[model samples]
Target: MSQPQPERGHMMPRRTFNRWVQNPVLEDYALRYAPKSFRRWSEWTVMNSALGGIAYMADFAIGGSVALTYGFANAITSILVVAAIIFLTGIPIAYYSAKYNIDMDLLTRGAGFGYYGSTLTSLVYASFTFIYFSLEGSVMAQALQEFFHIPLAIGYLICSLIVIPLVMFGMTALSKLQVITQPVWLVLMLGPFIAIAFKDPSAFSHWVQFGGASASGSHFSSLEFGLAAGVTLSLIAQIGEQVDYLRFMPNLSTQNRSKWWLAVMFAGPGWVILGAIKQLGGSLLASWIAPAMGSKAADEPIKMYTQAFHTVIGSGYAALALATFFVLLSQIKINVTNAYSGSLSWSNFFSRIFHSHPGRIVWLFLNVGIALGLMEAGVFGFLNTVLGFYSNLAVAWIGAVVSDLVINKGLLKISPSYIEFKRGHLYNFNPVGFGSMIIAAGVSIAAFFGAFGAVLQAYSPFLSIALAFVLAPVIALVTRGKYYIARENAFEKSDRHHEIHKHSELPNEIICASCEFEYEKVDMLYCPFHKAPICSLCCSLESQCHDMCKAEQSTH
Candidate 1:
């Protein structure tokens, strides 16, 4: 019998693919590696956009809530501790992500979690982005309700819809928005402190000893401290947002290595440093205003900013305007980031599971839709409960990643020196990262339900981190890193070199056989399908080929 030949087509089917990848502007290349050619933005612009994500006023609201529930001392200590941990852990994550042009979802696939293993983490990360998006959007809705008498439902829709257009242009529009809004946000952020410092300095002194709503009336209780830490740890997934922009940082050059490292440090782990300070500021402000506004109102971000505005501009219309300006600016700044990161996360999730990617814009609407649904369901009322519960999963995933980077890579030498994320080279499941995350999450969730008694139960989130960190290295040692990669390198040496070239020197264009679009050489890859290089979008949506290039090596 004659040998059979593979079916041939000039392009992949459009019916099975998404519109976002078909349209470059809408796709934003979220799921795949960020080619050198696409990374044309200056480091300052990328850093500003990443930093803009920190503009979320919810951190203040969270701080205020913790202070009111756990006492000032526990809230302050918890903020500082979580900040330190986030900063230290984020360093390696950001460094690898930028150097390799991979986001956290892709990075996980190489760092011990295999392709499928990391997909679980992608779901966890996607959930984090949307959950927080809903929380932050709810705050914006409340502000709208107070200022304009807009119904909460309508405000929620407005808040969710506004971010879609901003994200449509992807990094291009995002970078500009972040840079323009940064100065204004800083001024408004600092204005309140300046007013308080000058107008009623004694108010700060009174706030220092305020124990808030704690029955114990002391900040140093171990139980309260543990509970507070659980709530604060929920923000651990934020490193995912930092990595989104870090992937676009200009490659390190001999002349600019120092500046490059500085930018990464300041924009990466350094975000938590600023976050902790803001949390503390919020705690103090909330305590000072609690008496006048009533305890419930004081814990709300809107009221906290409103009081600060009153301190400076005095009561009535002027105060309301200042308050509204601060709230609106802060919301826009953070929500853009929330929506952007959420879209990337959803892209990561659906692409791997379904073996198809529609484009980042499709996921943008999907993320916003999920968030909007949560808002309509009244997510704000369950904020503490939701955050506390989510902390367990967030800590496990982060801890596993950190353990692989710090311990598996550093101490055990089990992980690769560089991140290997191309679909052609990774295992479907690496026991080290996958095992550790599962074990840690399992134990922590048990403790969270009082399985280990009140103290351990209260500190379950912290326990999850510690357990995952210890377990990741142990799993790597046991497995001997056999499952980390399916194949060492699939691309030819010449192709590898082509992948690393700077955008200007590389050929300006190539035609994707699948989509029939002319893209830059950097945007196209040599696919075995159609016997030509195709755009990453086409590669993602090309289900007919069934990844024939890696089929032999694929664990799946």
Candidate 2:
């Protein structure tokens, strides 16, 4: 028995937007697999781009907010703990995603969650992009308000729209932007800290004891530490953004193994090392500037850096200019990543459900549009509440993915060693990842609302991690790893013909039956309906195919 072929006359022409959406730089394989030929960038270039998105100013605001709400001792302790966990969990996810040359959505799919099950995480990731974009844009608008007296409302529009052009072309545009600004961003970000230390020799000593409006500000409290960590933990999902570029990393090899590991470690989990420092800096700067700028204003990065620079520059106008410039540059650098990742997530989310992709660029505009709406609605004011609630979902999502990767796959060896993410060959849902995330998120979110107790509410994120870690393997064991892979790779013959695609295979191109264009075999699959090989892009857009090939296989 063999798979059936569709009647020749019934085959419909391939309807794909590849012409518009498949710009190597813009689409970057948002809706399909990133084959060997497309991943041509050097390790340094991809690493820099991943690292560039880490310049987001929200960390400053988050750092200051947590310290103000909780105390410096608690905030600092929680920050350290969260950073450690984020780094540890990020390593395997980053390594696997980079090695497979797939984005986070695809990684999640093969990490235990099935094709459609990954959509929940994709939406969660999409929401994160828009939420953080709005926050960073708000920070930029605050700078506009301070420097040009632009109304916050109008400035929000300008800040939100400005990054659209920069992000339109995807990694090609963003990588260059990140590299060019890397040096300047570093100077501005670090210059203020050095200037503050030199100008006020006692700044550190005083900051250590600053009360920050909270009675426990200068000292640690377990309750406050848990609470602070819960809010900061919302950022755990940021690894997905880093993965968006790291997926572009050139394949690891014996020659580049050291550099590959370095790039993955630094750009992946390593972003948090610098992020935590900026947070602490923000907390310290907030205290130093509070009396002059007012408590609420001190938490703003624009104000924190302005006061820090005022001492060194010795002029209010000059300091304001420097702060405004830094804010705009930092915001642009990060928002581009936010938008790019959002587009990828949205493309995955919609393409799966709707079975259509207008283009990754279309989703880019939609993502920015949603973020702009949230910004205009003053979502910035509820940052704490929003982040606290969001942490439950984010922690559960990341926790489940990490559990499957580290425990189910690594320790138990129940799931496949390699990611198997093609939709044509993956189950619609997998209980191992899906069920664990649901239980974890449900219980954690319930606790967050005080359904359990005040103590439970404070430690909801930890509970989510614990539950996810415990449940993932239990579920995998119970399910017998049946859903980890739907079937053997469709392209492989007898499991012996499986090919590990290499960049050197660029000249070995397959012709897309409908498009009449050549592409790497990695992106082409046999189309039984057309009785010829078709590119994945065309396979995706062929609404008329109706899984004829898979159905035919089932009957055999």
Candidate 3:
């Protein structure tokens, strides 16, 4: 409990959050909606920040690893197939998130999961953050070791600790950091590839013919393709990170509709397109260097790019310098995003269960600390093994949410038209999304561990997606959508405007009695226990009241 207790018989005391929590600009509305007032960033600004996270070099490592294991054909096919799936599913989720101005965890609560049901998803999303953070940080550590002769262990510490201050400022600082670095990142990333192509045109043809060590030997095997796709599918949770920034997009209107769609489409699902390209590029570079470096070391991004840069630079030291700088820039750009999003998910998860929040900044440190531990534990060594196992749960979670968004809400019309994230208005658990995710994750995990035969084991993540997608709608129908909304919203009018317009029929701003801070109407709700308007974060932390508002509303 970060909040201090109020005197007995007194109204809920105004919370005294530390400086970080008190400033919405730094906090970035973690654990709640991004209000209309706070969401003032231009469409391109938000999109750039969201897309900046894709600068991570792990895609190169994963691509190189997959190519070495499955040969060129299977690796290329699997990467493209998974990218297409990620893009199609990202459409509805991105649109709804931007329109409603809520992050993935809050979106999950209203989409199919209930108030407390999304706590599980918060954990899932948090895992994606730290896992990727460690991967990216490991790349940066390798660069430090190569350039400065720093020990790998100390390099990991330096890389992990440096991003804390950058992410502590949240979106406000990140947006500027991303915009400033985007051009330099682009030039550095593309320079080596161009140099390699120009230095020896024959290298491209040789790369295409590379069979590596795979049994298939440059040919496609269904089993190998499935296995490669499973590893790539682990990136499915990346949509959550994209929407964390997308939630701050300005409201769409006739004047900005075209720009808004372009921004969302490019920044949201569009990230996978570039990601797939990077993976292919990594695969190509691995092939070029494999004869000299050996396939065992081919998956390292630093090694792959260093060879590419050497084709043009000619000087070994100069090539290494350029490659090291590129790696450091890419790692920092992505890790800050990873740390920021992880803090939001952790804040959502812990605030719901423990009914306490020291601040988003506190959780930021916790997320980075966990990632640092993973880096020290050598998580990078088990990259494919870890991502392969994780893809099952990640696909299951995303599949359930996508089903709820496209099928249940859009096609079936069983769920609400708008997202409702307030604690007092939702059930603690909704079997539709939560149950589907659990069943899907459990079965797929069993299959992944060889509970099923070899073919099923290879395609376990795909199986998770299919089962969760089909099961979500079935559970929603069986429950008759009753769990979606526990009661009528107590904070807004019940007219057509309220249902149709996302933020209509509410005051422009209302002061939260608990925090005593004025917030946009959408983030505040009526609290019968306190008999005042309470913001969502404060309502989530008010354990003493025990949800009297929902109980009282049911009697009426």
Candidate 4:
């Protein structure tokens, strides 16, 4: 076995260090580059895991609320518009993330946000996770309250606890969980629509013209359109959730080229296609159940599903049971993803700000705890308000990223060809993305508050997207992309393997420099700390070294 080399700083002994590095399941090591050895899943498996996140009940709830408030025509039209936008923006971003094996945070840094500029984006993305986490958990809590007569507080605890163990395992365990539960969840999800179609064959016609409860009826109102757009736009950040799994896609090759592209295309922008459908379904069900459960209960996902199931199943007891089952399965599928992605966002946030990452698992718990608290405090009541406000920021951030990638990287040569995310090789802020986002957010928020009166206010979300998209390229052209990359890559001469680890390993073992642990070559990197190969986890948590070795290297 390769032995540990001595370093000047205080260090843990080899055995103790090995224990710390042993946690591959919990510590997927979000802060470091993903090594080839660690990315062993097949393309199909990775795609499945990515698709699993789409099982969230929020789609149903959002759809239901829109249908109940705006009626069928506006809800369907808004969904189609949002779906097209999400698809176009998601494609290139997903392709790049899979091609590079990096997360959205890393992708944002290279796209034009700069190093720390993307850190703000991370906070935005993290907020998406927690907010959605609370929403999904609340859905689960409602199911528990209906099925088991559990108190809402106890339901919230149960909903939060179930996802922790699943997230702790990271991608490996998450992939299996998704695959195993997907078929059941899908059947349950589609069951209602199928039953509605059969039971009331003419329901579709009635649904098509339904204009909701608005004062204007089926006629379009600019204020109503803007309000609907804002609610729909909150889903813009879901692209980050897709990239979390896209990073694990197998490298494209000649033999697997078709499958590779298909996986990327379907798993990436394809998510919104399903999302729009779910939203429409929610709207329809909310409309159907509003009379029985009242308008307030119509927006609740569990209640919506329960009424839909009751229409087909006939037996009230069986209907409640099936509805609870579907709700539970759907919440578990989505909350695990929420917790997992939140951990990655938090890991990126603290590592840059504090220059320390305890581990992804630590942040995983912290993120879940925050969501749990929100669920207990009643997240459902504020759902529309929260989502509408957040949509402005979300649209602005995504608009900046997409504009820079398509314009700055494709048309202009200002930004670097690849993403450079490491702290050592990036400016603290880049005016291009940051400035575009600020202007977009500020203007849209002002409009949302009716600064230009009710007519312009409803269209604030669209304004945010347009302003950011237009501003990003202009800012990049003016700045000439000077701040995009701080340094050229110093390790350009190294092969892929060498870039990941400093030393080629013997069959059996290698040594870690930071913590002085000995392990299989798979676990080690040629870190300069002890002048030997160090395990990946130890290298991730090492705060003192200041990235002395790869100072000039770019990260995404």
Candidate 5:
């Protein structure tokens, strides 16, 4: 049953792409390795761009909404608890992605999920982008409605369309945009807090006791705390967007080790620290304005900050204008990232299923168009219901990935130490990670719908995390790690047992036989079907070959 070896001298016909796919600046290596040469930005610039997306106003709304529902003690306790978990889980994922220069989708492919297995996660990630895009866009529209007396429907279109040009250029434009606005953003973000603290120092004392609509009042309730935490846990997928930028980090070296680590830690998971603070601050402002603006109005950042600035600035019109300006700036900064990351996720998903890529630009419009529709449909009106339901799925996906990194690879040493993402090298399915996520998400979603009980329903997201974390390593052990790799890598044929880490030590450039383009050696795989070397992207887009390389290898 053994198959014949590939003909050594034969070459298959090559494939071609349009100008958009060929351009490095616009494409930004959407579905392949971000080679060392393309990662030309300094550590500081990359870190800033990665952190820019954290400026979203959704935190403000989420915090205010949760606090208004669950009271002060439960809301504050839940935010801190979820922030700690997010910070801890973010570290290893961020470190590995930066070290290997692969985006989250590629990392999922090699970490434990096999080639096609990660398509589900890609869809999950793409959903995160558009859902949050709609949420953030809704915040911007609310600001426009308040300031200009415009209809929410028209404002939605304006908010969604403005970021298209800014994000079309990919990292090249995003880097500059993030760096230029960061300083002003920091000042504007903190100004209201400082003014509120100095003007009415006693406001903090009153904030602790003001309960909007919670049955528990100022006291904590475990059930209410769990519900609040579930809403905040939906932010777990924000790390994927962080990894999209972290993949552009330059190779780690002794000279830049300290700077690199700092950037990764802060820009990666450290985002939650600021995010948690913004949430608590939003809670505080919501309390201050609830008496005047009513409970529902308190959740809107535009309304919350406008009243906060009234204490600092004398003119009512000036305060409204400043708050409007801040909201627009924050939304533009984050929506660009949302739109950009969504495009990358959709590209990863469809390119695998269809074996064709029109380019990242085509997906960008699709992602934005979906978000625009959601915004017009008023996605923000049902914020708590939407996010609580989504947290079950998001937490499960993250939990499975983290378990693979920290347990299977680092502890048990069952999975490959280095990432192996090339299509030719990976199997189509691996139950270790993908199966764990499906089981966990399914169980937790059932609990969310009260399959277990009221307490478990309130804490369904925790169940998802626990199940995924425990299941990944157990499944890997039971499967005997057979599904991790389909065949020994063929590119380093001098030693059939060579590890992929050695590929990074080899020469950088190799011209792919399928595309006739020079790609880094790490992204190129030996193709048995073509009897030549091929780049990962080119290999992914190949449909006629039917993965003949892995098929031939498995026969042995």
Candidate 6:
């Protein structure tokens, strides 16, 4: 754990941006890295919280939506292929953020997008949270309507507001909520499946026989498969939420070698393995119930779970109660994460644009408010269309980031091995990530809108992925990786370079002129504009200063 260094001199007291984000319990270092002291939880504890968000019943809803729109075979294959892509792409992102001890936003700032460029991706990521938040909240509202007869509109408000306090204290409260409820969620989730399997041995065969209404019965179309895959692919952004917890993992070492790898594997890319299973489960449950519940009801978690639970509990009211409880558990568990990650994304987005941050909590309400509006506007009804269009952008962003990590950083050496996320060291935009994302998303969205043809439209996700993968390196080579970095060795040139820590020695302190606050030696910088030391956070939010700190020629 790194200790805070107290300094001899302090500046005139003004509000510190860091102060807005410095809660030992609540803030969870939203604006900075998760140093060793704050990352005190065991690997398993973090893993549980990370996996808890997967409790969202939307996987079932999405799978069913895709299966209904397409067919069983295509839906299953799409879920599997998308899961493989998500898991593979997630590996480098999860590993980098965890090892570097930075959040997803900070990682984005370094991974070829630069400081402000990542702001666009921040909005993209924030949208993912709210869109999913509304979807999950709608499912919960349905549960409320089922068990309590709560109006859907009122239910939406109740669902949105319920998660606010749980997330205000950050991961401290969230981690516990997930851990405590996980056992019951698991049992309630599995009990119905087991009961159903034992009761009807031929049910699985029946599920395979049932094709969607629009389909040639029991046949698979390439179009159906592509649409199914595109819808499922929107979930690529789930890795960002996983990275939120992964960043808190204690630094890996030889002492905890096995545990470290286990944590990274399961909490990182391993999340998709479970996601795939849940999608399949949703598809099966929907396939069996679609005939009885109407096709639309198969798209609702409350309905699907209730039908399954009835098979187990054998009483209508009792089954409804149990299913509603499971839905609430799943929704609350995931909504908290949605709220938390949305807060972080909004913080990054507004702070960069506005040059100041009110705090992450402010954005929390804003995010929920937007999601609430969407729920009222019936975003859930258009789930397929919304997610299908949204996946083009989502895949574009993730594909760009992944391509940079695997191709540019690994093969081309067009980017750095280590992440340098500080604002002064990054350009406003890097063509490698920014350009590729736009081009990929543009093409995919065009196809999604039926610009190319029916076949290409269905395969829009693959087109987005392919273009992003190809363009990242091509742009890096064309630009010669110039915009990828602002100033070479800029951190070393800063006033308070990192000092080697020794057990017997006290660390140095430096004060920021703008905020007049003390920071550890490594956090301070010599601001060329202010002509005095400034901490990284202040330097980051300093708009008037521009890039004056690095406003010089670079022969390096």
- Taken over the whole model, the C-alpha lDDT of each candidate is 0.81, 0.85, 0.88, 0.80, 0.90, 0.83
Instruction: Put down candidate 6 lDDT per residue, 1-556, tens digits, no spaces.
Output: 2233334233444546445466657667676656555677888998899999889989989988877777777888899989999999999998887777678888888787888889989999999999999999999999999899999999999999999999999889989999999998999888888999998657689778768763656577778889888889999999999989988887666577699778878988899998888888888888888889889788899999898998897999888899999999999999999999999899888878888877888899999999999999999999888999899999999889998988898999988777767777788888889889999999999999899999999999889988998999999999988887677543354322212211113335556577765555445555656666667678778877668756753533
Q: How many residue pairs clash per model? A: 0, 2, 0, 6, 0, 0
Question: Against the hidden true structure, what lDDT does model 1 obtain?
Answer: 0.81
Error of 3 at 537 (Å): 0.9
The candidate scoring highest on lDDT is: 5
Q: Rank the candidates by TM-score, best first.
A: 5, 3, 2, 6, 1, 4
lDDT of 5 by residue, 1-556 (tens): 2122334455555589988899989898999989877889989999999998889999999999988888899899999999999999999999989988899999999878899999999999999999999999999999999999889999999998899898889999999999999889889999989998999877787789966688889789999999999999999999999999999987777678899999999999999999999999988888888888888888999998898788889689999999999999999999999999999999999999999999999999999999999999889989988999999999998999999999999999999777888888899999999999999999999999999999999999999999999999999999988888887666655532123333434344777777888876678788877777778998899998898888888788
Off by over 4 Å in 5: 1-12, 492-506
Which 10 successive residues of model 2 have the least lDDT summed? 494-503
How much does each candidate deviate from the true structure in C-alpha RMSD?
4.2, 3.0, 3.3, 4.4, 3.3, 3.1
Report the backbone clash tally of model 2: 2
Tens digits of per-residue lDDT, candidate 1, 1-556, equal 2122233445445333556565555666687767666788877777888998899888888888888888788888899989999999899999888787778998898888987789889889989988999998988888888889999999999999988888888888888888988998898888889989999998777777778888666448888888888988899899999998898888776666788898898888888877888888888888888888877877778888888888888876777777877888888888888888888988887877787776788888999999999999999888778999999999999999989988888787888766766554566688899989999999999999999999899999999999999999888888888888665453334444224532335345666666666655434555665776566556655567766766655545
Assess candidate 4 and give its TM-score to the true structure: 0.89
lDDT of 2 by residue, 1-556 (tens): 1223324444555454556575677777896667676777899999999999989899999998887778678888889999999999899999988887789998998888897899999999999999999999999999999999999999999998899888878888889999999999999999988988788968788778876766665887787888889988999999999999888888776688899999999999999999999889888888787767777787899998888889889999999999899999999999999999999999999988887888888899999999999999998888788998999999898999999999988999998877777666667799999889999999999999999999999999999988987899999999999888655554554332123533333435667776656665455567777877677667656667677776776676
Model 3, 1-556: lDDT tens per residue? 1122223344544687888887887788998888766777899999999999899999999999898888899999999999999999899889989888889999999888899999999999999999999999999999898889999999989998999999988998999999999999998888888887778888789877778777989988999899999999999999999999999998777678899999999998999999999999988888888889998788889998888888878899998998999999999999999999999999999999999988899999999999999999999989889999999999999999999999999999998877888898888899989999999999999999999999999999999999999999999999999898876665565532134343333336667778877776677777777776778888899988887877776787
lDDT of 1 at 61: 82
In candidate 3, which residue pairs clash?
none
> Model 2: what TM-score?
0.94
| Runs in model 6 lying further than 4 Å from the true structure | 1-20, 489-513, 516-524, 553-556
